[model samples]
Target: MLTGLKTVSKKQKDQFEKEGYLIIKGLFSKQEIAEIDQTFMEMSKKTIKGCFEPIMDQSSEVEDPLKRYPRMMHPHRVNDVAMKYMLHPKVMLILSDLFNENALAAQSMFYFKPPLARGQALHQDNFYLKVEPGTCIAAWTAVDKADLENGTLLVVPKTNNDEIYCPELADSKESFTNQYVKVPKGLKAVPAIMNQGDVLFFNGNLIHGSYRNKTKDRFRKAFICHYAGESTTKISGFYSPLFREDGSKVEPELNPDSGPCGNEFDTVYPH
Candidate 1:
């Protein structure tokens, strides 16, 4: 085990149990944040022309004249520094607890929220992940300061265990469809504001999304990691590239040699 792993105290764990999410402040150092930001900016500048226009039209309703220029999906494998942060020890500790053992990285994404960008539709991670309930998590780390002005994430309290609900899709050309988790009647959701280097860990079933960035110049950059427990199984119609411990792709099928899945790790977590 890595020394000085950021363990979640009882209070923090309780908060997560109640709200379906928790924020760890300053999980990354300022120097680390700066390096990631620099890497992102450089990559953004290089890929900007080829990416921006198409993604904007697909993911948001912002018109060309009103949209803020933003970048999406920087490949992490291309950057060693990014890959290090993705597998950081502190992160792995929390994930191990959630998954009740060693976990595998299911997906990684880099989201850059520039000024005037529209908020993402409120939805759960499992909507796209298609994994068993409570078997996955999303670790969202801020490379730059995130707040209301810069499109910080907003989440409904205590809504994780509920069955998923379909959200009203805003008129957009986005490729992925969004379905929000149902919120209880008369309850208001809260916005989660995070400073640079902070990481927000939430259940894959949590209902969350961000508000549009209304700030003039600030940019909110977040690196997100999605991980699944050893017992996690694939849902039909949703696909993820499964990998073994050595990172080689596993063949599609369930068998003794196919690795663990379908409640195999139910007792792995120590109560």
Candidate 2:
């Protein structure tokens, strides 16, 4: 167990428990965010197979900027910096406090919400991760200032413990991803405005997503990761070989349940 880690306080833990999400201001330093920016900026110029496949040619037939700079999936498996943040001790410590047990690093993603990029639809993380016994927790680090204009994340408070609802087809005009989860009655989705270096941690079942980048120049870039507790016995095969805080691999049993829609949209979509 990690000792003497002062990242998460008792009040913060209680807030997360009560609201289903918590935002830690400046959880990552400005220097750290700059490093991430430089790394991904360099990466955007080339293709890394299944990780990142940005199109360098702007004159190509693909018009969408996201097609040119798609969200990088499982980036930690390829980039040293991404892996460093995925298992960053401070994040691991806070996750331990939230789970009340050791945490396992399961997945990492970097979103380059460039100008004119479409936002992801509201959906649950476990709907895709399929962590059994408990749900995954997402640590979303905003690399740039996030607001409604630049497509900041949105969440429905107190929806953490709700059962996974089958998703409906999303409006392609607004969302890049096809899956969309409807907010339950009496619940409303609210924007999570954050500054650079801030990290938002939310439950796996939280109904959350963002709107299209309504601004002309700003890009709402973010570094996001998902984790499961040490006791997790199964997880989706896509995120297999979960890692420990020490960087050791642990292969949990594969979870085959793909929610109500089967695996039609299983291919990596914006998240």
lDDT of each: 0.63, 0.86
- Candidate 2, residues 1-271: lDDT per residue as tens digits? 4465457788998889887999999877899899999998887778998789776788641467777877888889999988989998878988988999999999998899988788888888889899988899999999999999999999999899899999999877778788899999999999999999999999998899999998878889999999999999998888888999889999989887433112223354322
Per-candidate TM equals 0.77, 0.93
What pairs collide in candidate 2?
none
Q: Lowest lDDT 10-mer window, candidate 2? A: 257-266
For model 1, state the Cα shift of residue 166 in Å: 2.4
What CA root-mean-square deviation does each model show from the true structure? 8.5, 3.0
User: Model 1 reaches what TM-score against the true structure?
Assistant: 0.77
Which portions of model 2 miss their true places by more than 4 Å?
1-5, 60-62, 257-271
Q: For residues 1-271, could you state the per-residue lDDT of candidate 1 as single tens digits?
A: 5688787888988787777888999988999888878877676555344233333343453453123344343244456666666667788778776556666666556777766666665677665556653546789998888887888888887777766665564433321223334456876679888899999998877888776777877777888877776666563222245433345543233212111111111112111
Candidate 1: C-alpha lDDT: 0.63
lDDT of 2: 0.86
